[model samples]
Target: MRAKIYGGCVSRDILNFDEAELIKLVSYNARSSLATLGSNNAAKNISKKHYDSLLNIESKFQRRMVESDFNNQILESAGKGDYDLLLIDFLVDRFHLAEIEGKLVTRSVEFLRSGIKPDRVVNTFSDQYLKLWKEGVDNLFNTVNNTVGLEAIRINKVYWTSVATNPQDSMMLNEKWDIEKNNAKLDAMYEYVENILPSSSIIEVDKNLLVADSDHKWGLSPFHFTDDYYRRMVKIFNA
Candidate 1:
């Protein structure tokens, strides 16, 4: 299976895992939102200052994803129909958008860590944000129908884990995130997307599988789950 992924590492990690050797990742775009993908802005490139800061990012894949988000090219590869599946998870949508020089870019964790400030941050909860998201979602639905069709699309239904394998990690997640509130917002957004593509496949995992990994490569985060989670996800995908 050739797959193109958008949003976050959940799908990518699953496809990249040894258990998922039959699945080949065709393209992976991250740190982007549905709201940014369908935008037409004058400056499609990131500012030189931002690009310079991006160079310091430890992972090359992350740098490329960040650039892709700024360039608004998240859906470009998927249009060619080279991939059989388009896997999407909305963890990246949690990152608020930052408006810089009239262009709205995802204020990703990498961008935040880089210390490059944007002109303003747009709150995701605002009515205007929802409006933009809806418009983007419409654009995505049409594009997929014209290109890969709805059957090839998969929405990886995921949420922040309220618990972690390690007690320390669990405490840290609670300290940093209001899990219940954030999950509520995510559920609403996911429901909106599901409503748009009712025929598309929805990848659902047991709620018990949503436990954070204490030894995850990216460190403990609510969205970064244990190896068991990825394994179960792959099994579900195959089924």
Candidate 2:
């Protein structure tokens, strides 16, 4: 039966990759730092045309993804995430779990509408939870600290879908983004994002979370997938 994932994309090559080959590159250097440095100056951190200049990039695809403004928007959001206090309030007020919830403290959420991601949102917020909450924001720090956190949100794909050339949606294409406005917001937040949670978490996509019984759905872009990708995703969810 046909499904969201393409079963045909699967081939002998993919099936044969085994455990080691699939996860080899998942462990990488500081991908989180790039997100923190996504202001106008982000271009300096990346390599331009490979072999054309002194800085030749080994992986052009990865570099292009890093240089894209679309990616910058996604990363900065996670880097300055401060939804914990709101989440806790929801649990206590809405779910009526205050008795079991125990001690809680208030934090300023004025940054929400101001387009300003407060300084050290993840690190600082987690630090407070050390006494109040049951758990620390270590994973939260790890999420923003690495590219995988940005990938996990899945909203990035939606953002790319909104901006990228698509005949299906011409209206969205016409909506011009105010580059200067976004850059200002990003510039204001970069300093705070520099300090983040440290962890040695291994990426486990192809080896565990992302695999298919039979499908060639590798990927079209960093986030967007093809028919085969969706098909394989269905297989993963089912598994």
Candidate 3:
């Protein structure tokens, strides 16, 4: 999935930017880092010589992850502007907060190489994470092209998911769900998001949408979603 998003921006032809004929979307995982910085020490994946160049892109891309960007050539402005929607996932940010705060938590690859149990990492970064959450989220929004008028939404957790595993990959970089701490920051995130964006710009997820039950279909990880959910999410965009 990460690679797919990167592929969208790696070159220039991913999407046409006609506001009338094209509906553009810019999405990124804000957890690891932004622009060029790797949030959960994921920066190591990038070379120091080229890392800075990777970010602050004229193309408008990502951090631990990469994203689609709107360049005059890659995309001509849709007339009103370029993109029609902007989506952010709250999961990676939570995962990122844990990595930043946990005294022992580190990127899964780093932890694996050191032979440390992911769950054994101590939970101590909550305070520090909360302090930076609002500032980070706000700064991010401010960075967008105002003509875009971004629509932001938070994804509710897929129930019965394990705390210590990466849903997309089986990497173990976390141990506890830390729901108390995670949700506290999430609430604060929504509060600030509401204040900065119009009520319609933010989508409030249904509380019972992904609960664990006989219909349970999200065991793969917290970030994974059902096809129906994906279809419904696209409906939220104004494209």
Which residue pairs come into collision in candidate 1?
none
Top of the candidates by lDDT: 1
Ranking by lDDT: 1, 3, 2
Q: 179 in model 3: Cα distance from truth in Å?
A: 3.9
List the RMSD of every prediction in angstroms: 2.3, 21.1, 10.5
**Please, what are the lDDT tens digits per residue for candidate 3 over residues 30-133?**
22322212223321232233334335433342323322111111111211343444444444444432122222222322223323223333222455554455
What Cα-based lDDT does every candidate model obtain?
A: 0.79, 0.25, 0.34
Off by more than 4 A, model 3: 1-81, 96-125, 145-147, 150-176, 212-219
TM-score of 3: 0.48
TM-score of every prediction relative to native: 0.89, 0.19, 0.48
- Higher-ranked by lDDT: 1 or 2: 1
Q: Cα deviation in Å at residue 197, candidate 2?
A: 5.7
User: TM-score: which candidate is best?
Assistant: 1
Question: Stretches of candidate 1 above 4 Å error?
Answer: 18-20, 40-53, 56-59, 113-115
